[model samples]
Target: MTCQRRIVSCLLVGISLGLLFTPALGREVSDIKPANPNLCPKGREILKYFQSIYGKRMLSGYNVYVHTPDDYEQTGMLAAIWGRDVQWLPPVDEVIAHVKAHGYLLTLHWHWFFGGDSAWKSKRKTPVNVARVVTPGTPEHATAMKEMAAAADILEKLQEAGIVVLWRPLHEIDGGWFWWTDLDRPENTAELWRMMFRFFTEERKLNNLIWVYSAGVGDLKKKPVELRKRFYPGAEYVDISGIDLYGVNPAEDEEPYWTFFRAMAEVSPGKMLALGECDELPNPQKLAAGRLPIWLYGLPWWGTPSARRPVEQAIATMRHPFVVTLDELPAFGDEDPPPVVGILSPMDDGSAWFPEGSVTVEGYAVDRRGKVVRLEFWANDQLVGQLANPPRQFRWQWTDAPSGCYDLRAVAIDDAGQRFRSNRIHVNVGVVDAARGRPVTASGGENPSAAVDGNYYTSWRAPTEAEEAWIMIDLGQVHSIHQVNLIWGWKIHAEHFAIETAKEAPSQAASWHRVYEGKNLPWEVWKATHRARFAPTEARYVRIHFFRRAARQTWGGYDLAAVEIPIPPSKGAE
Candidate 1:
């Protein structure tokens, strides 16, 4: 988007946000042990605990709500720290119960709610006028404050319950995927950070927070400190400093972790350094053997590491002495641990298609301090499957399911008769076709799934006069076979469009890998099926990201060999 358009979305309607909260009387920053002195008692205790373990040990953490500690893993780690997102926060009472039961440290981040403007939800825009956004009395200022106020409404509950937060707002500001990051205007990013600090801590009196400044692992050429220098809000506003890492095999890229450690130490001198987020957990034994300063805590983001080997490595990493799990945490006051339950399949808002008209149920549960006696899977309160003394990775298949929307959940009952519920996931199951099923999503298109739904009677069409548009199909599970067939009908499509695939659903930009690029389609290939086959690949989702669309609607269009367009053997996507 142009700079003007970036500034346009900055406009906000309501100005009554700051009026809802009482003004702040600033608390003195501590020169003592705990970094943020004004932190709630629990927050202080958590930070102090982190300080006690800095460089000497590591805390096992995950991207799951430790409703019990038995998430998806075959062997539950019951990790001590949890990574969560603000957009979909669980109920505060549930959070309090879990923390009371587990003594877990919590960290929260926001994806800026559809890249900062709900209008841009479909077509994500990365640039922002953050400098104007922080300016008082500007519409841009209104836009940000309103969001903060809405978020503060939720945060206030945690504060009232004496729950301290490791608030990591605007995380990975150097990463262009988030709305706040504007590399060309890093100073503006800093301004935005300071604005949030003053608004949350000073204006809102949210004293139950330890502000975490999380940066992205920027370009390899730039030192971590150099990448974050312009964006750091300052030592006073930030309590912990860290960076996010991904796709790095610790054994191979060990030096970068050390480089980041030293740079974060320099970035926020004397403050506790953390691994803000990671895909692969660094081996605890390797860290201890390397003889370098270890992070205060590390968060391995959700999802089992891609394949089985990494999963095994992660399980091993959590078992080492240098790593701390929930059992090792000091008790806050022993509250009976609730049976933890999680619905591991058909994620919330995820869709599925069952060829045999049956939905497969998969989940995990554990009574950390006791034994879980029964597990049940439900669809809209109707019991679909039940198990007695279910295994860690419970499995069941429900047959004769109709195609419709369903609220799915799994419940666990402990020996003490305490029943715990898994978070609900809403999913749509569609009718399968001869070609197979396609659970689809798109940037902006009517019935995008029709393109792959194998019903030639229906087809996908681009938005009239769209600057950019895209269509995506999630196959629900990875398929080894390649080739996507655009059945029947054909036409000249976008001059610049690319076909991409990822082993998993493409949530983040990192997951997408481009396999074929169609520069322009031949005009005369109408009334025929088109297939753009590349080297055989494994993928669960295929996306056609169109940079430009045809002037007229396109039914289907392609041909690499016929059009003399060469296919590369797996080209990496940025």
Candidate 2:
């Protein structure tokens, strides 16, 4: 059978099965309208609803690039269908009808090219030029017109069905990979994008479509910020701006991802933003903890669910309260206002110290207009605990929280749907005696024991102004240490120091490996604490080798009021 025949056969089979199980339509597409005159209402409502729950809730979406709409039917997830999929899978009209009947939002993206090949392989026989294709009165223009008219057929069907779509086309246009933005000639991609936008909106009169303009992380020559500015199709042509991200490990580095988000927001303020396509779904807990700006929607690439683990993570992320699934969405125009909340305990700028082991964190929340619905606590971008309504004072216990420093905050939601986040607090959990309070003798200090006597008033004074003086501490046992806090004596600080560790006693011939080094350390003045953090390492003997003093006078030399070390639970303990 021919390719078209095979596609038709597969679509018919899906439709037959759909008809047997499909239910009556729950909502009419015409009821949804964009708040902005230039955009579609359904698309606007989806964006508004998601923004309302951002940092308190997230919305889950999946792409059906190679699969039929029936794939989502079994999973009950919001549907993201690609324009190319219509040609080889279920027909476009059928997919729209199925989503509408099931009360699901539909997002459409087109990997469109000038020629008919969906894969976008450049033709060697006939070189493709975007400049010529966008210019009128050219053969390339005529070919592009014919191909786009065919795509218009699909949009016209959707319009006739009164189906509003989050339509993204010519996506990742800033990149050199796609034929539309070919590296050989990238000068005309912006013009080509504008031409297509006008063709679809003005000539075709496709009002039911919500125009989405998207780019990738970077271009061939420029970064995301500059590339987005260079290829922007203008605000009048786009309702939403987005980025296509893949292979993002949020646990490792989230700075670049956040940078792109902020850059897009700066370039197009008030416009909705989305994660257009990503291979890995971000942790919903982190998304709700204010790690990144509020995104309207997130749609992982179509084939991500082929792996079981990714699918599981996707499901869990979708299940988060911050994420809105098709079933959890509010009706059009019925979204409730979010409430305001604050954290009353543990001053935002202050650090809370807790002993190693089980501990309870406390905070207070309030909502002026509506009753507070829930209070959620986050630790290091992950949701650790939550409390239900009626309780203004919130407390959660961490039974096995390891010793370390954590970024802590609380998010409270009210009955009106408003979300309020408290200022972040730095919490330090430390194990006592990690340093064993043993006397750490320094070559230049006269009272070495004062450095570890757990007293802030007394001081350990160095005898002479020596750049190579060393201070050594015996941990008493081989322990895993992650952080060391040094308290500088009043008005005195070290100009340079190196933290070294060894399994054996420190001696002139001892093999002391350097763990950390610092230069020009500042005196806190108020708190007098300087913290050195590093990856956990096992050592019995630790030392601080001072190279210089901030004070030039030899009378004071170097003075340390106190030193503290924190140890986390070992892997064997867990």
Candidate 3:
């Protein structure tokens, strides 16, 4: 296909994926009215800045004065999002020194003492109704309002200086350990969130502050994702969907990040996503693995880096090609209009292609004051291709990429030589996935098509049956295949399963040849990819037959990918 048509196809595929994904939101996201209609110009600018980079880049952040991010001074520096708690609240002068002076975005979190009812206290972190905090005409309500008023005053000071604040209050409300929480009762938590919203936007008229609704890590391990919606305060009350990720190994335990990313996707579609607080940051290699992306920015919780985030890991993560660092962020204070640019293809939400074929890449660009002369596409920061202002759209053809993760970006150069950047996006040119976008059927289940959508967030769940559940896909044509990858779900995993392939639809079960069978699977498969390889076989359809489900869980979220390649004994069994 031609480059222009290819761009159209990619975009159509993006929209088909989900209207709610970052890719489908496209440029409209930057132009959309802020959740808070009364948002200050500075705050809107920061929000737009994040929207522009969402899914393509992640901003490295560290709690200000925490002194931990400094460990990466050797190779990387992180200051895109500056964070701090409102204990006594930072001295306005200190805030100016740490954030404003450095042109960093400031974020404030409140760990309200609650009359010394400390949430951090190991023994006292139990959930409290906090009804008085949300209810009026009560001592707790009056005291909470006083704290908010003081916080609003601080935000107002920043607004006067054209500095913006990302106000994240009542964070981690579902985490029963927090002091002012309703916990399992998400309605109570939503009330608290909305109350804070009205007080800041309607009552105090604090336009400089952007509201960030952040969920905590506690529920990620225990509760179903449906709770994410219950805990949400609604899109009108939120500017960002944030998750505080801590207490997990970024290397081994990656499920949390993906789980939260998808959960928020369902809870508040089209909202910018953020890592409100974190104990560790994934390194560049982990990012390249295509497991985590699209955190517009992140703040490492106040603590020294340990094994979870070593100095080396911090450096690599901040130094990642697409990571927006202290020196890389746009000048928020700039008044002149620069060219706006965005990548339109390779939908960062999860568009993967096989290396066997060429892929077309595209971008969108415009200059408000000058002529956009040319647009350049770069891979891992290395200039790859450039299109001189196209007659219509910016399109570039990408071919011959190996099976690996690529960090891609676009830069628009104007007639005057001024350059503008589109947020970097991670695209996977992986081994051919035969099942991608193909027809899928299951014995019984919901969203059978999800198993082949190329997005892990959506899955083909098997019927909640005691036995005999299966999922199959048609390749439309017979081809030699040797490997299959099953990205399983958390909790609900496949315990005993088999793989079968047929050149044509089999009329009888006895006609199907079982190529691979997994019996008594090692416990390790619970949270990772289960790969089964076999001798080169030609088939038009592949089926995974499950005879027995795990006793503890039902058949649930599942995704499958098949590759046509020679035998590889090391990666999996053949």
Q: Report, for every candidate in turn, its global Cα lDDT versus the true structure.
A: 0.61, 0.60, 0.64
> What does candidate 2 score in Cα RMSD to the true structure?
20.3
How many clashing residue pairs, candidate 3?
1
lDDT by residue (339-372, candidate 3, tens digit) is: 5565545544345443454567764565545578
RMSD of 3: 17.0
Q: What residue runs in model 1 are displaced by over 4 Å at the alpha carbon? A: 1-36, 65-72, 90-103, 114-127, 220-224, 333-574
TM-score of each predicted structure versus truth = 0.53, 0.48, 0.52
Model 3 error, position 88 (Å): 5.0
Where does model 2 exceed 4 Å of error?
A: 1-56, 67-89, 118-125, 182-187, 219-224, 302-309, 333-574
Deviating ranges (above 4 Å) for candidate 3: 1-31, 65-69, 72-76, 121-128, 219-221, 286-289, 302-305, 334-574
Ranking by TM-score: 1, 3, 2
TM-score, candidate number 2: 0.48
Best by lDDT: 3
